[model samples]
Target: MPREITVALVQMAPELANPEANLRKMGDFVEKICTEQRTDLIVFPELSYTGTELGLKATDLAERVPGHATNYLAKRANEFNSYVVFGLVIKEKVESILYNGVVCLGPEGDVVTDYRKV
Candidate 1:
């Protein structure tokens, strides 16, 4: 058996500390890619939402899994019926706990898995 998948790698410069803008841009890319062709997977750069120059702002930018960013991207995944992968800063219940993480969203908009950078 042979299988083939179409993947889109999105490379964009995120606004420093501006999650909302970054999310919107990502969604735009998703819509554009899906409309242009049938894509099986879409991948975004690490720390795509929060630019890598966080300094002490990482704490404020960190979010829990299934939080705002995931929720936002999940909608896009379901809308286009494609898998989506992206990286961001994740935080646990405790304020100081944070990890560089990657998340994969399924076609149904459910989280397939989340990986934390150790």
Candidate 2:
């Protein structure tokens, strides 16, 4: 038998140029989905954390590959006992650029994986 997981996609509208509010919004949205829905995984839109039009500098919100965001998301994953995938701004030391990326968190409070957008 092939094992499968259910997924819920949240199409959220985030405020541009304001990552703090957006992150809070994302947290709230995630909480709502986990509480009210039935799914094994949740997928959020691109740049879900910071929004797409922030125009932020690399260092402004760039996070280490396994930094706070991953840890935070992982905690949620543990609490909800579900996998999550959300977009974020990640730092690249070589070019000092913040690459848009999506990180996946496992239920065990571990970074399951991350894909840096080109």
Candidate 3:
């Protein structure tokens, strides 16, 4: 038998500096997509959790990996039994250091892979 998978590409406008609101929006999209079809993976645009224009305030908007955003998305992933991929501003443990990062969450609500934009 041939292997197959369903993927969802989400396009939306993220509210600047409001991670919580963005997360809610993302969760809504996931729920809507998963409800409509059986999806294996969902992909969101870059900086999906934070708006594109983040001047110097990007630092304040930055969060650690497995932080609020990932945790929130993970629940949805597990609930829907699908993988979720999205971008966010990641804060380093040393503080003051941040990167544009992408995360992939497994169907079990675990971090599968994390990549930082170069």
lDDT of 3 by residue, 1-118 (tens): 9999999999899998888899899999999999999999999999999877898989889989889999999999999999999999989897788889999999999999999986
Lowest-scoring 10 consecutive residues by lDDT in candidate 1?
Answer: 47-56
Over 1-118, each residue of candidate 1 has an lDDT whose tens digit, in order, gives: 9999999999899999999999999999999999999999999999997878898999999999999999999999999999999889999999899998999999999999999999
Residue 47 in candidate 3 has what lDDT?
94
Off by over 4 Å in 3: none
- Backbone Cα, N, C clashes tallied per candidate: 0, 0, 0
Off by over 4 Å in 1: none
The lDDT, on a scale of 0 to 1, for candidate 1 is 0.94
lDDT of 3 at 108: 100
Q: Provide the overall lDDT of each model, using Cα atoms, as 2-decimal numbers.
A: 0.94, 0.79, 0.93
Q: Model 3 Cα displacement at 2 (Å)? A: 3.6
The candidate that achieves the highest TM-score relative to the unseen native structure: 1
Better of 1 and 2 by lDDT: 1
Supply the TM-score for candidate 1: 0.98
lDDT of 2 by residue, 1-118 (tens): 9987788898988666567787677667767888997668888888787777666453576777788767777888778888888888888765476788999988777889999988
